[model samples]
Target: MRIYGPNGTTLGAPTGNTRRAGASGFALPDAIATPETRAAATPKAAGNIDALLAMQGIEDPLERRKRSVQRGRGALDVLDDLKIGLLSGNFDASTVNRLRDAAASLKSTSGDPGLDAVLSEIELRVEVELAKAGQF
Candidate 1:
């Protein structure tokens, strides 16, 4: 299985042929999705408009960042779920491609001036996140 970072970049394949650490010694696929493991996998935050628009109800700079990151997290989660469905015979090729295109567009048009200003710096991360959820 392919796991992606919060920004949507491929996080390399699961250590192929390697076993994950376990209580007794090691485990494989089953060990990968244990409740503890999943619980520990926190989603990363993205964007930072709240600070730029402090008068718009978002007072705390950190809170603004947290909200933006949460949004990104939601999009990534959607993408991951859709990816699974598509790979599992739920989506036809044409639909998949269409969704991919849509995702690309969303990624390009996040509509946040702060992000747009730093387009050079944030494009990759934005695209990756949006692409993951077909929100581009």
Candidate 2:
């Protein structure tokens, strides 16, 4: 294919599989091991477990309630997406799995009785859908 320069001049005609000079030709030094790179490459054991325990240990009631509300809303959004996918006949096992996972993560209460009722109803609907799809 013809390659043009900035001024619309034809630079060169290169065919497919042509490799430009200086591309992928550089190598890192053998002695370039750094603590930061080593740490990044290594997996930290108990990191996620510690974080989950810390979250559960949170002392603020309002913070916990907020997190619950956010989770409930997220599950609701997943249900909405599932509804759309079902209507369009474009859903798959992954979509159903997402809905199930979201529903499972949601709390039954969010410090608001009305919202909790709505979330419970949504969760029931999700369960029904999963049952109908043979996923339950």
Candidate 3:
């Protein structure tokens, strides 16, 4: 059992003094650093610009075929439109302009001989139509 002092006498007094725990005799080794130290340790970034440019330069055969198909289809569609316009007696010069643009796109080779041959045939039809319209 314990007894307490008067409340007024112990009101502002501290409970006890604190002390650091003593070392246990075990110590950790210091870290060893490399002799070569960098003044500014900046991270190096990969050169993606060159890689992206190289990728852009590479042409895909499938993609080329697809583009050729689209161009051929587009030219045929324009020819159909021109025929409809002429038969309806409402022919427009803009149709001829679109035909001209299609003709330009059809000149590129698709790398596949079969596709190129088909595209050439379509190109010939476009030229004939252009000549008839006096826009060749």
Per-model TM against the reference:
0.30, 0.50, 0.64
lDDT of 3 at 120: 96
Estimate, for each residue in 1-136, the C-alpha lDDT of model 3 and write its tens digit: 4435432233333333323244654333323522333265455667778898899999899998898999999999999999999989989999999999999999999999988998899999999999999943
- On residues 1-136, what C-alpha lDDT tens digit does candidate 1 reach at each position? 6556554435434535555685566455544553322335455556576765666763565665555555555545555655677679675454445445534443543345674444323435545644554643
Best candidate per TM-score, number? 3
Q: Of the candidates shown, which would achieve the greatest lDDT relative to the real structure?
A: 3
lDDT of each: 0.50, 0.68, 0.81
lDDT (Cα, 0-100) at 109 in candidate 2: 62
Clash number for each model: 8, 0, 0
Q: Scored by Cα lDDT, where does model 3 land? A: 0.81
Collision pairs in model 1: 45-69, 46-69, 79-133, 102-136, 103-136, 105-136, 106-136, 107-136
TM-score for model 1? 0.30
Error of 1 at 133 (Å): 11
Model 2, span 1-136: residue lDDT tens: 6535433334333323344446666343334343221123343476689889988887685776787778777877887887888889887678788878977876456766776787788788878877887843
Q: Give lDDT: candidate 2, residue 93.
A: 78
Model 3 earns a TM-score of 0.64
